[model samples]
Target: MEERPGRFLGVDPGAVRVGLALSDDDARVALPFDTVKREKNDKAAARQVRSVLEAAEVPCAALAGVVVGLPLRLDGSEGEAARRVRRFAEALELTLGVPLHFVDERLSTVAVERTLRTLNVPRAEQRRVVDQAAAALLLQAFLDARGQETWPEADSDEAVAEGPSPGDEPAPAGPRGRERRAGARPRRKRR
Candidate 1:
């Protein structure tokens, strides 16, 4: 369990289960990490996620920030599901004391399902892993665009360089502004 620095956590928020992924130290590759079972409590779910982040396996890695999948509709409009995800993201951000960035996850699940079919993954197993796979896809999309000039420039206030150390006070309130990225639209904060 080697600790890698500068890793980013990616999340796919769901009502029943939350999928997670982690980026490499360089932020070039994304890998499926784990799935957290949600007990209908946002705070509890966020705690579970924080546990994963604080795992011994990645002890030295500083959490750069968090990337959440915003499940927008095909027409580019946010529906109830997207709103739910945003709320979850906000809660998780507060819990982890990290900045949050959102990526449009229009067909991340569909793409993961297609890949699972191509790989001949068993249906039962696919059900268990699809969310993790979708999370990885969403994270990869963000990593891929991060180095491109066309990517939307995130506000300086919204970009986190490092997370709080253990036993330290939780980070201050995050930036209210949205992160602008290429091909991905920013999620508006609900009133």
Candidate 2:
């Protein structure tokens, strides 16, 4: 098999399972690889990921880096879940000796669930597939961020300063007289 440059492995770590995604040789696109359940112990998940890296023949010299999703609250506060993610990262770093990149994953799972549902994944089977889907989504976001040439980085102060930009016009009313963004659930205002 031909080897590629910058072979990146993206991970979505969970309490019980870890989802894996792999980028193309050039590290441009990320595709879902596998979801490993926590077997006899959580060590199984780590082993499974290690196996994928080994079987892919991704040379250590060319293994560019790893991307890990960092769990955070909607308000950007770190919590217990975030702590677990940190610990997992620490362990992986020790084992892989490769650099680890963190991507904000505040709502990645929710986004992945909606995506899977739209793809007609059965409810009974979603749990089995959610983590891997999340990994793919996270990696895709990371790739898109890097692919945008000449895009200015928005300052944190301005990123959330307003509701929507000029181009973000509200979606047209639907046939049932409901106004909802395409593929998004209707929003409810808090009292």
Candidate 3:
């Protein structure tokens, strides 16, 4: 097979099972891969995930990174589930010795279920594959955001105070880190 740049693994950690998805060799599209039984502890789960990835035989060098779903609350606050996922992701990154990224996964599963229902997938089959689909959604979102070119760097207080020099257009959102981006920057008041 012709090798491309690299592949990225997407993970969705649930209470009982962990879903997995993999990006195409070009790292553009996400395909649902498999699901693994979760361990009670974060480190153990990480190890289990490592083994699963190794079984795929995609060398470490071939992995561009790992994208994990972070199930943040509707109000944008992290709950226990989010915290647990973070812990698991951290351990997995350390074990795999690869880059790890977390994407806001609020309602990701719900969206996947909706899509599956629209596709007329059986409820039983949906249960078997929803997690993997959610993983693909998370990875796809990350890939989409990373592909944007018009994103600007984070603006400091002075930058925001400058307020675009009277006529400058508001910059398109970046990779969601700055105070003005779509997800990372926390806003005090609801818009």
Candidate 4:
């Protein structure tokens, strides 16, 4: 049998930046890793993210999955930013050939900014670290929920990066129609 990978990668994508995070060997905790410049093209950006994943303690070949921040609007509708992320995430999923999932990330950066300010982090420092911090926050949330086997309703995506568009068939759900990305622990079977 093939060994399931041991680490999860987190991604926080922005117009000008892409934050990367890596989980502990057990995929139980996440820590900020690096911030890559978002190139004008998404394939280039995926290449940069691939570089970061390869640099982690666990290489891309050992990746369990990727959890990407899906920037949904406050109203729970996806906007331009969400679409943009889906594009980069799709390209990245192809580049890495790993399982892909999306976590609703409305206000995640705002929350991180508030914490940084409370900690008295200077504006310049906050700008440098906020995205990575947000990635860690999102990844941690996912890991915690996965541990409990009850993912938060608001944090999960109805469809992952390969979501359905208007006039399209509903996107496929994770194993057995339960919500999550591929490679996640399957929900316990019903009696």
Candidate with the greatest TM-score versus the true structure:
4
Q: Where is model 3 more than 4 Å wrong at Cα?
A: 1-5, 150-191
Q: Give TM per candidate.
A: 0.72, 0.68, 0.74, 0.74
lDDT of model 3 at position 61: 64
RMSD of each: 18.4, 11.0, 12.7, 16.9
Give the worst 10-residue stretch by lDDT in candidate 2.
38-47
Residues 47-92, model 2: lDDT tens digits: 5667666786755456677789999888998899888788777777
Tens-digit lDDT track for model 1 on 61-116?
37777889998998999999998888888888888877788999888888899999
Instruction: For each of the candidates, give the backbone clash count.
Output: 1, 0, 0, 0
1-191 in candidate 3: lDDT tens per residue?
A: 33235899999999999999999987889999989998998899988888887898866667888999999999999999898888888898888877888999999999999999999999999999999999999999998887764345457443235345768766555546433643455456668
Instruction: Give Cα distance to truth, residue 93, candidate 4, Å.
Output: 0.4
Instruction: State each model's CA lDDT, in order.
Output: 0.81, 0.78, 0.86, 0.86
| Model 4 spans > 4 angstroms off | 1-3, 150-191
RMSD of 4: 16.9
Error of 2 at 106 (Å): 1.2
- Indicate the TM-score of model 2: 0.68
Better of 1 and 3 by lDDT: 3
Error of 3 at 54 (Å): 1.7
* Displacement of the residue 63 alpha carbon in candidate 3, Å: 1.0
* Candidate 2 colliding pairs, count: 0
| Candidate 3 backbone collisions, by pair | none
Give the range of the ten consecutive residues with the poorest summed lDDT in model 1: 170-179
Model 4 error, position 187 (Å)? 50
Q: How would you encode candidate 4's per-residue C-alpha lDDT over 141-161 as one tens digit per residue?
A: 989878876444544775244
Which residue pairs show backbone clashes in model 2?
none
